[model samples]
Target: MIVQQRAYQHPHQPSEVRLVVYETAAAARRVEGMPDDAGYLVTEEWRGAGKVIKTLGFFPDRTPALDVLSARAQELEGQLYRPVAPAA
Candidate 1:
């Protein structure tokens, strides 16, 4: 289950991007009743003029996912990438 989501836009690009953070595997099964083999799946979608141009996926622990997202946001020069909130 996606616990949080955010949208971003780069200053130099015409694309709008989205970042989605999913719940941990254990929480997924307990909360959503879905079995997730991957520890956590983070996804980024790049859209141009309301159309998706590219999509990237990463399966990493929560910490690594934050690092990856920060790097990606910097690389894209996006306006913002919200920090991940601690899971309750």
Candidate 2:
């Protein structure tokens, strides 16, 4: 289930990025030897090079998910993440 959706504008480039926070759960039935990757899913999308998708992380709860989104917004605004290396 989706909890929140946020859009951010790039400070340097004329581009917009969309963020989605959603909750996911493991299936009741067994899927063999699969990892139980169940939790809040944070995804980012931008219209560059045919729609790029980046998974921020799998948070345990809503607060941390939103916190990440907030920090990402700040980073996009050139107030943070300037010193960080470029994402792969």
Candidate 3:
């Protein structure tokens, strides 16, 4: 007799936020059409299993946006990921 064991996959958890900051108004506008005076645009996105779940944005500042993102991630038991270098 031969027996095989099946692999187990973890259940899908709440989506995580990948925060990206666009330092320049031009770059932010190119990506999300934000106004030039926006100063900065912080994008929050969730991409998992080869699909994008959701994408949101906050304008003019990164620090406060990140604070809110962190709180939301904590509430949802998810994680926040960001790029090491600033966007051009």
TM-score of each: 0.52, 0.66, 0.43
lDDT of 1 by residue, 1-88 (tens): 7755656765556566776666565434553444455565566765666655333444556666666656676765544433333223
Candidate 1, RMSD to the unseen true structure: 7.0
Clashes (candidate 2): 0
lDDT of 3: 0.42
**Candidate 3 structure, TM-score to reference:** 0.43
Residue 75's lDDT in candidate 1: 64
lDDT string for model 3 (1-88, tens) is: 1011111122444333354444454443554444656544444455446545333444566576556545544544432232222222
For model 1, what is the alpha-carbon lDDT of residue 39? 63
Which one wins on TM-score? 2
RMSD of each: 7.0, 7.2, 13.7
Which model is ahead, 2 or 3, in terms of TM-score? 2
State the lDDT of candidate 2 residue by residue for 1-88, as single tens digits.
Answer: 8787776654565445777788878663354543366767787877545678888977777799889977776776574222222223
Sort by TM-score, top down from the best: 2, 1, 3
